[model samples]
Target: MERKKRHPQGSGPTFDQLSAFIAQLEAKGQNLDNPWLMTKILSKFTEDIQRQVLEEKVPSDDTRWNLRQQMHCLDMVLTQEEKIELQLPKRSEIKTLESSKKEYGKTKDIRNVKFCFYSDEKDHWSTHCPVFKDPKKNSQHLKNTNRCVGCGFRSHTLAECKSKGCQRCGKKHHTSTCFEAEASDFDRTKVKSDDARKKTASAGHNVVDGDEEDDPEAQESSTENSEENHTVLTAKHSATKRENQEGSNIFLLSGTLRTKHPHSDEFVQLTVLLDTGADRSFIEATLVHDLELPQQGSVLMKLCTFGNQKTTVKCMKTRLSIWDICGKQHDLNPYAYKDLTQGNVQGVLDIKDLMYINEKKIRLSSSAHGYIEPHQPRVIIGCDQLWQFIKFDEPQFTLPSGLLLIPTIIGYMVSGRKFQNGDIPELLDIHDTSLA
Candidate 1:
């Protein structure tokens, strides 16, 4: 029996999650035959569990070298669909191993049987047959038309045949080369190791395999810079770290929009994050191009950078709607811009009017920063001309810990420390009797 290598242990919860997922798969009598599904499963495992499994099972050739070798060794056995599904390198990708193009190395057209072009029979090609180069047998071989397997030529190889190539396209290449095939994820980003990505995931994490950018996302725009598709703004804010950020005073409400590009019949669910500090919302140019969103007009907008430099950006006005956030479709007429901070952020809209803030909480005198948290916000709400309409619950008194708990419709709003990163804010317990 083959012994498996001992791997670094994973966290208990992560191990449990992996075990449950595997058990479910096993209950269905499934084998890990599909590489894509294996990769997809690998993505769900926590960062540590993935490292363990990859280190133990795929240590030798995780860089895809083995895949290339398998593709070539099983080239003859692979079906048309299999060839595409596997993303096997094209005849062109592994050209180094093939015989020089100038020299037609023993190329096979008819599968399974290797025929000798010189002797005009099976088992070997003209490369090394005993009677391959004989001048006398060559004439006899050509005369026997009954022994032709392809092109009705006696003892001639397909490479030397005068027959026209694939009928589908006028080109000499194979018929399959003319049409486009389903694309593989390999065509875009190459997945990286966990430790390798952790170094860069300080601000946020990629929901999918680390390669967040797609091929279409790299296209050039009319502007100098390129667009980011579904990129969540990763700009970090300064905040002191706390032991338990889950208890910080913060409320995260999310909504989904079912929309279809005007030109496309396919409707997709897009999630948007709501933030108050952002002056305007933005969307990726890919959504605009794919959905064929029309530009109503353009305006000059000033943007403040982390470095304190101000830059003027040209934004286009477009309308987007999310139907069921508060039981009604909220429509936003926002301006679209390129080079957004993050991906998933569709657009920043002026939504201060939709919110119902407690006036008493807003009037409470507080001078402390909030907690730091980690989360992805897709939409930011900016308070502009309608700032006066905002209201907050006023706290008449403070707690022993200097935290003020203000009541709101959803939950109590606590004010004390600065809020950053999705930290749960401290809430005032109504039993404290400070307000009474």
Candidate 2:
């Protein structure tokens, strides 16, 4: 047998293979003590194991002693290796791998097929529809075609459609066609009406008194009413907007990293959000359970959220091994959370969708943008451990639209906010949290 045919050091030919080879040589009437026969059998043993056998003290008279003792030594080494492998940390679990396969199968089904809401066609998805490129034209087409503004279907109208409404207005209309300014104005008007009703109820006697004109309180009330009327009109009809715009978009940094399986050579892919503002790193508890990770004891953590709300919870820590863009491995121990944010970092992206990135020849960690799954990240690499995973030597790319592409150990992360088709929803208020 060729030398290359021998298995590697950690996993060599099985004991059965060695036994069969020896039996074959014995049947040929070859001398079991022949040095050539012994050498051939030894070749099948891994290089490391062979070396160990050579160090054995065999009486010079017993040449076949090493060959006969090989099986017992090999078995001992294999068992020890198995124990060590079990002690090592693994990235992916068998259950996760199986579920991923099922998810992939589901993604291939007819329901997951791409379709354009604008043209009601399968040639493209709604995000890439030609009609959707222009808000006015898309809305006009939906109206002209008698399609539901909420879900782009002809079977129902906007009011009757059961699909989720615009995230901006919470109205029965698509986000692409939502007018946030209108919603804000309406809300302000309702609040003003409620205030006026309350004032009328509390000061009913003052309004009926003609003698109140001489009273300073009555005069002040009249002046306030006039100013309020002027303010309402200015808000409704003024072309100029307020100092802080009602709607603003915010994008958090996120990317995908490769993780190695502890027992096997296979690597697992994980999507993670890089939060420099966060004090502690976190991983989803469900994922930790699924991966069957080893916990290094528990910590009593004090979690603080928006409005200074604080809660005490028990947190478990587990080791993680992730590969960077250059295939450098990083080991980390992050606390576990029952859940993370529901928001996703970016929408489905493809190379064709981002021609600018291609024009600039920007290198990315992920090989294919189309294959980057659009799912909420389960891992958050907080500031406490963020520097260890960042590549300070690499250059950062800033797009014309204010979107920033940052180079980190894991990948080139796409971050910073961008207005989607001039549709800016309400500004998101992110509260910094403290973890102990």
Candidate 3:
């Protein structure tokens, strides 16, 4: 006789228990990503709890809190931002609080509640601000402070000081920062001292000085070279910063994605961003609120984000069926990364399970993407898998070096736009650094 397979059994927590559990997790800075755990917690929510969450408990009886709506309410409560703006107390609430304080002969200073930049009102929206018009009166007045470093006054910001020609030798610059000017003054002083010494020696006896005075021309050339080198260094530093900024910017492929659990008969469709370089696939927590998949084994892994920032990512793995928009399912064992994203791109497809098709789209398993939508794919395909779908075709060129340099990084030098008529799709190498 065949034996029945054992399954992970769990009952949903009560509404009160679930709420408290969520609060504890949030306090510890934990993120919920396990679809099974999420299902268990929300399943036990009573109609009263759901109504309370949806504000349906209010005196208005017309409020209908559907399953999706209730799930969204729970999701909003679970998520938080690094910098949460505090909601100011309403005028009525402030008045009530002040009245209560007055009963005890106390007063409350609530001046800090005002946050509008365009208004002087204690409480106001930007649209109601009176100073928004005629901004000259409301401006920060930064131009008035643009005093000249040379003059120490507002007449001219870039021009030299007319009052004190040059502080160093009445020539053209400030004494502190003028190295060349200071050197010239030192040379002049040395020449004057030598002339005085020679005149004094001639008065006493006949004396001839054989040594020649130090050359100012050589020193001046050296100073000019130093200045030129400093300028070159500054230009190089600016260039390096520009290159680093360009290299660090993100370029992710986006498209619509459809996914479902292994045991689930129904597929859930969502928009996903593919990380063309992530080791494992991931799904957003919010998208799995309705999914009832059993919890798989938990794993702890080190994840490195942009700029090589290392962090620990707690994940739960389960076999997921990735379906094409046409309903074709692709077998993929993907992990649900706890609170990885905060948007509609619910799942990140792995590059290992994907292949680029034609010249315009990417294929997940065998289903390819075409056209565009509001929520496109943001899936980051991994490098190892990306290599398989990428191949370069070297165009014919007669050169002297006898070397074929496949232009990967700088494809812009060859082409202006992509997919023009008569353009062969196979020759288009998007996986190269040009697009990658």
Worst 10 residues of 2 by lDDT: 229-238
- Off by more than 4 A, model 2: 1-249, 307-309, 348-353, 365-367, 370-373, 419-426, 429-436
Q: Please, what are the lDDT tens digits per residue for candidate 2 over residues 1-436?
A: 2222234655555556776777797799865665676677666666765776565635344544655565555556556555765797664665565566653223223336887767678988664576566656767878988877776667666676666677666877776676552355678889877776576457432211111114344344444333111110000001113312433234467767787666686887777877765656778898787676788765544454435544545667788888776777788788788866644454434344367677767665544442334456778887668887777898887765566778877767777765456666444433333433
Compare candidates 1 and 3 on lDDT and give the better one: 1
List candidate 3 segments past 4 Å from native: 1-251, 260-267, 306-309, 325-328, 339-371, 374-436
> Is candidate 2 or 3 superior in TM-score?
2
Instruction: State the local distance difference test value for candidate 2.
Output: 0.60
Task: Give the Cα error of residue 145 in candidate 1, in Å.
Answer: 99
What global local distance difference test value does model 3 have? Answer: 0.37
Q: How do all the candidates rank in terms of TM-score, highest first?
A: 2, 1, 3
Give lDDT: candidate 1, residue 273: 33
Model 1, residue 271: displacement in angstroms?
A: 3.3
Model 3, residue 414: distance off in Å is 20
Query: Could you tell me which 10 consecutive residues in candidate 1 have the lowest summed lDDT?
Result: 427-436
Task: Please state the error at residue 188 of candidate 2 in Å.
Answer: 37
lDDT of 1 by residue, 1-436 (tens): 1101111234132323444566687689876446785556455434644555455554465555332232232222223334454587766656654644323224433434676555557766543366535433443454454423223344456566554643444544222222311233464234435454565456232111223333331333224233332222212122223423333332222233445556565655553333333434555555566667777665544444344543445556666654432234455655565544332221121123112123223321111122212333333323221132122552333433433444322123333433334655544211100000
Indicate the residue-level lDDT of 305 in model 1: 37
